[model samples]
Target: MVREHQYEAARFLWGEGAIERMGEVLAAAGVDRAMVVCGEHVGANEELMDSVENALGDRHVHTYTGARGDTPLGTVETGVETFEQHDADGLVSVGGGSASDTAKAISVFAAEEGRTLHEMKTQTTDDGESHIPDLPAPKTPVFAVSTTLSAAEVSNIFGVTDEKAGDKVVILDEKIRPRVCVYDPAATATTPASTIASTGMNALDHAVEILYSDGHAENPFYQATAEKAIDLLVTNLPAAVNDRDPEALAAAQLGAGLSGFGIVGGISINHGINHPLCARHPVSHGDGNSILLPHGIRFTYDAVPERMARLAGALGVEVEGGKATDEATLEAMCDVVRELQEEIGVPYRLRDVGVDRDDFEAMAEIAAHDSAMANNPKRVTASDIVALLEAAW
Candidate 1:
């Protein structure tokens, strides 16, 4: 089989005090005035904010703290308004996925005037074909300082929830990719343990899906990065959350960043389902990933059994006699993931996270249309999604 892959690499500065170099990064990017984007909790952290302000120096123009979970469309609108009011030339995202996604959304909306988010967002037809409109306008550069493991900073994709429609609208634009990313473990230290744990699982899910996602499965570069990401997450996630070890957290952060490589290839059904699950419910994207990943693995196992079995080695699971049947290896892989989730105190069941069994059908309908579904190694139907949801529940 012949395959071609396209990947974009982002400049990353990682270390204990990497945030202090924000000014140099901004200067190199020719961004004179930058707005800091973050969630309320992050905004209230005076110490962290102080660090960011000092690092950015005179280049920091304003702070928009209205970023919310699910990257609500209204919040993005507010961010764009704030950006224009302050006359900012770039965005510096300083928190988790929501903050990064909000900044990405603002960059797009601010650049392309006269178009509503609904009009620019990726849309699905009645027959289930998805379309992403070309966003040719140049966007404001984004510099991300990640404080969670969601790794939204490195990808050109972002999701915004349509409050009325109760669905997440995904957008893809190459220009929205961050100009630079800072992975300071100290920046993540202030985030809650539960968030770190759940998002760590989310990063692991990204690596797992990449191994078998369409086109990517055959690409050796994607395979190597995904495997290394899995190994790093499996080894360091528990200590990062439980003991708050700086070294361990650094490794976990690198793992999360590497997992974002999946975006260049594609993600599979787990992320496709997680998008709607987070949009419709109070669940965090990380929690959604935590709960759905095992079921997604099982759902797609038969189609990519050999690739699935390879995950066991990456997960540090030792097979008996150095080999096992694919079915047995699959079970071992799931067991390893579930045990890691338990160790990290992330939810492993949909019911535990307040997901209603009755809403499964609607969630399935929306998930079936997600762009990530197009890359699933196995052909997936709405009915298949429903069954997976039921099993996870």
Candidate 2:
């Protein structure tokens, strides 16, 4: 277990109308000029943009509405150019994960002085050894106005895809975590139920994986937070998924933000494979996670059986305790995840969602060495990953 003593904390503002206090948050951070990074749909809404501009007062200098799912390398480069051209002192990420990730990519590149994005790309050897080039902390801070439950704003890691290589490179640094995270249910009102539900499952995956992660074995703080995150997501996600209730949206947002706390400690097998699936297919990150989560739990259950029992309980499964083997409780946990996936209208099998069977070998090969794989509760070989993918398929 690669345990560390690091504990990461972020400033979070949650409720309705959180965006109304944007100027106050920015001013407190000593930001003078800021640019908005968002998706086309959010950017095209002139009224909403005007409202945000008004909230920023004179600090809002430009809007770059180019962020897309997975934040491809070219998109990050384009956003960097916009940030420099506008002379923005900070960033207001106005959408979901992709937008926030794009802003983080811009912040990192901007801080590197003369280095190009390619020069800053994470280096991984043929033997699966990886190296992240050290760069200075970003002078410019990020203030996020989240529209989904993915909780991208709460973590410093960014996943940027290289389309040419068909791989997503992840970068990590504490400095890239948002200076302020604004979670207003009203902001999420425009999001589709499918998107909301998928991301909610993604949050649940984070909490579940953290519970069994060896890296977090000594950090009770992370375990406690992960437990609460699971409870909140399980209790509130149904309302958000079924009714689109604003109150539930707020709860899910808070839950996701809390679950994000685990990311600093680490996540295990589920996230390890999920990233590679997204990089290989045209799958959304959240969808990939939702589809693969149950299988991941099953794969690592024996490594952390007690935690898996607790997870089953958190998911509302009634498992017999005393004489029951860990296998029974673990199966119950997977059952609940599958039930939730169906309840939220997400695909459960790899083939059900159009994953190409021929590419399974290639994807498993990449996943076996993905950076997040380092933290899995049990070490996995490429052949092990292939078997898991086949089982899901």
Off by over 4 Å in 2: 1-6, 113-132, 318-325
> TM-scores for all candidates?
0.95, 0.93
Task: Give the Cα RMSD of candidate 1.
Answer: 2.0
User: How well does candidate 2 score on lDDT at residue 260?
Assistant: 89
**lDDT of predicted model 2:** 0.80
Clashes of 2: 0
Model 1: worst 10 consecutive residues (lDDT sum): 317-326
